[model samples]
Target: MIPIDLQILKYIFMEKPIYYFKMKPYFQTSEYHDLCMYITNRSDTQNSDRLDKRDYTVFDLETTGFLPEIGHEILSIGAVRMNGNSEKLDEMHQLIKPIRPVPNHILSLTNLSRDALNQAPSFLEGFQRFLTFSENSTLVAHPAHFDVRFLRAMVKRWKLPEYSPPCIDSQQMAKYALPDVSHRLDPLLHYFNIHSLERHHALNDANMTADLFSELLLIMKKEHNITTYSVLQQLLNRQKS
Candidate 1:
């Protein structure tokens, strides 16, 4: 029998200041570059001149807290499928049960009660479903680096071998799109004239981010002349250098 507790603990880490401090800078290292390149290149998405002609899977994760290495756990996952024109095709949202009781603060922040999560899918089950939700599309997320880390942690915790690329990050593109403004999701949504479905809800937030990403894609293509996923990755990689 798989010790679920031990598998859960694999996602949590002993708080190590050294690793935490140097994590962001690590993205600039050649080692990180090579790893990301290897995984992303293995994907079969075809290159296209029109940025809007490629489909993407925009997703989001709501966690118990910020630190993935500690006790922070993914509480829910929300995803939306977009067509070649960036139109929403379908969606999936799963509330996940954590191994422990959720704190009051998290409950208040996410408005997800213990009773609610208790009825939801377990971590392993929910995560496997999320992989299926992704299909063969490029994963899109706001501040993708943080979410992707938690995702990779999920695979690690479950002892599953999964290759994850640094997904197409809307925040990075936003920084390039609206360089002199706030890149926070809520404010950006307002800037783009997008109405918020709800705040702090994983599914709603994913929907909002998906809309925001579509808007940013237009900006990236027109302003920076980036028109495909390949170019977008190359462009961001250059910024990392």
Candidate 2:
């Protein structure tokens, strides 16, 4: 056998053992400190940036049924992205195949059936396309709570991350902007003289919603000079509160 020191040297050279040690509390604490610093910096950056009015992707969905649970699913989604100037940027209309069969009542209501959606894409696929088409813009919908709830459930079902962007509800906005008149879409559309070529269809409803939003904005600007996103957000928050 070799000398002890020599044997030790041979073992060190041959094995090159990696000694694992628990990180000390101080070192582990610094990781949290670093994360906090990162978050602070990010928040500061976000706060320092100037806010601008953004385009909105107005959308509507026709579903197999009213309830999100109990196997109700979206049959079609229609969307149109409108710029700050109220010009349409991109549009999408897609049919979705529901996991459950379309009931006869629903089929009659939406004119969508199992056979009609046989070749259509799934909700996950269609929603992904809508996200891409929307392109970081805000979402607009009439009676938004209803549509948002359905969309949120669908997004959760597909394991999609939460949507962080803002959403504008023309219904509530109209309540604030035109309190004197009925807030229903049809009546509001008629009030603004917005023609609805087709009713109940997702695309046509989305188009009508987009038009109504534009008209409402114009009326707000002309009457109240409300033209900023921050102001709109504040007003919406106040209404909610």
Candidate 3:
């Protein structure tokens, strides 16, 4: 056998053991330090933390355009954490400098100016901060596919290692919970009688989505008796199929 020191050196040089996830973000807070890794194995269905007791990161993005593929880019990110509506946790909002100027319609919608973005972080850094804020929580969004698509697009654009997490789409859940009405955020908020919340702003949008998610969780629990993320994932998977 090789000598112990040499063996260790060989492993270190060639095939280092994975003590922490390689793709983990450059972390921000102590709360997120140990939890920066991507979600690899999902939780158990029956024995894990029930859906109402767990944490979720609801996020939104403002972009220069709709499609990330055709030179569209993210301009801002906003996120908030929720735990069964027990308490409102800290939220994260970041502006990212983009390659393109903000469009007139987009500027009118988001109220963000090019001047503001001049002082903001790069896309990679902003995304890293958002991920750090997310910690190990499940992700949620109004229409999750849009936000997730942006994220995946950024990962590819920046040449960063991949990072995709389990996400709950509040819009789709609203469709399931109240099938008769449109699943758009503003309409759902109106249907649920959630009032006074602003729209278009990223942070406001994220919080609004979280509120909708909380309402839907109650409906899901009562109607389907669903109580865990695993079960929710299974249900969502079936819907996709």
lDDT of each: 0.74, 0.72, 0.74
TM-scores, all candidates, are 0.79, 0.76, 0.79
- RMSD over all Cα atoms, model 1: 9.7
Q: List runs of model 3 lying over 4 Å from the truth.
A: 1-49
Any residue pairs clashing in model 2, and if so which? none
Task: Tell me, by lDDT, which candidate is best.
Answer: 1
**Candidate 1: lDDT of 183?**
84
Instruction: Tell me the TM-score of model 3.
Output: 0.79
Q: For residue 77, what is the lDDT in candidate 3?
A: 92
Candidate ranking under TM-score, highest first, comes to 1, 3, 2
User: Which ten residues in a row are the worst by lDDT in model 3?
Assistant: 15-24
Q: How do the residues 97-182 of candidate 1 rate in per-residue lDDT, one tens digit apiece?
A: 87656778889989888888999976656865776667567788888887888888755543345656537888888887898879
How does residue 110 of candidate 3 score in lDDT?
86
Model 2, 64-124: lDDT tens digits are: 6665633357899999888767898878899987765577877787777678798897665
Off by over 4 Å in 1: 1-50
Candidate 2 error regions (>4 Å):
1-53
Error in Å for residue 138 of model 2:
0.9
What lDDT score is found at residue 207 in candidate 1?
94
